[model samples]
Target: MDALHPHGMPKSAAETEARRLIADWAQQPDQQPVRHFPTAYRDTTPLPAYGTTPPVPQPDHRIVPAWAAGIAVASIGVGAGVTGIGCGAWLVLQGLASVTLTSVLLVTAPFAGLAMVTTAVAGAVGRIRAAVTTHVYEGPVTHHTEITNTSHQQGWFTRTRNDIS
Candidate 1:
């Protein structure tokens, strides 16, 4: 139909312009059917009721022995330290506080290096080799602990007693 009469009474210039745009937009490939909403629905939905509860996890008593804590902490520290150095270098490159970045790098690099060295030394010394014997019987103590480097290489051995007499 005719877009606009030279002297149309009610239709404004904006309505005419918008009609032309919609006419043009209809020809595009990826255009969707557009609809305008006057107002949004405002309300909260009733929450759903639930039944069964999740089971709690039982803590395993047979965990890494206390002696292994140091090695584990050291290993994790060294790993985190290395990651920090890399992040510090990146921050320094990204034009962050250069002084702070440099200080972090200086601190973390040495700790990372020292932690790696100590981890290696402690691993070589086999500090993780520990023995724990629980005495369940009151009369006689039957707990044997022996560390033998039978194999040429390093290994771990654990022995535990759990009995009531």
Candidate 2:
């Protein structure tokens, strides 16, 4: 069935009905194209020129004055210095604000106590282990001794001797 005609009209009937509707629409006065007629009078006045010719192009060489350049450099340096000082001050303030005694103690007290307890326990355990443990030497003992004597004589003459006992 064609979706455009729910009554299940034949294709030929649908085409004929569409053609009749188009013809009826074309015959209506509002749908007809309007005719444009040319005017009998003509305008003879010339239009006024409001634009002027553009100026001729010229090559430009821009040069900055020495004093002006110096001023620009000075200003940039001053600005950078001010910014650096401001940032330093801000960092110092932030550091001071964040490092309160209460906060420092609160954050570190538990760890400090834990470390002390751990150190005490470790020390006690180490002492007890050391007291209960004993090590004995199991190798032969040997002794070595060396004696040396050096004398500088006249005219860059030198004598040296080593004795091992």
Candidate 3:
């Protein structure tokens, strides 16, 4: 294989030279790029002297309420299981009563089952939501949020360079 071509295939030398020149030109920095202005309008003002140091959010690390999430998950699982088993039992009872006893009271099984299941699901969802909401700061580690002013001044043909700022 020659330098002009690879894999025993031939390409136009002029095209290859043009591609190389274009790549070199692309790598060069822009000559007349937009410049930053010293007195240009700014998007954000500097923090006030009193509030220059932002308040650091401190996490509650005295105790971890990890059990809340666990208990909530367990409760949700138990609720689902109970709902399933209760509904299945009610269905079975309804089927048995329909075949053997043929009583009008058998129709109430579905309603009872539905109510029980709805209650269980609601309780589970409530517990899960509580766990997620109230279970914050569940570790010994503290978290912090940092706010930085990154807004820069901009203008046409401004003398200020970004590197100096």
The count of backbone overlaps in candidate 2 is 0
C-alpha-based local distance difference test score of model 1: 0.72
- Runs in model 2 lying further than 4 Å from the true structure: 1-50, 101-165
Model 1 stretches with alpha carbons more than 4 Å out: 1-60, 96-165
lDDT of each: 0.72, 0.84, 0.73
Which pairs of residues collide in model 2? none
The better-scoring model by lDDT among 2 and 3 is 2
Q: Report residue 122 deviation for candidate 2 (angstroms).
A: 53
Task: State the lDDT of candidate 2 residue by residue for 62-158, as single tens digits.
Answer: 8999999999999999999999999999998998787978988998999999999999999999999999988888999888676666565677776
Clashes counted in candidate 1 amount to 0
- What would the C-alpha RMSD of candidate 3 be, to one decimal place? 38.8
- lDDT for position 36 in model 3: 88
Deviation from native of the Cα of residue 79 in model 3, angstroms:
1.6
**Residue 120 in candidate 1 has what lDDT?**
100
* 1-165: candidate 3 lDDT, tens digit per residue: 435466444557756777998898788858565788788544465566774565556898786479987898999999999999999999998887756443545767889899999999999999999888755466587555554444545675434323321
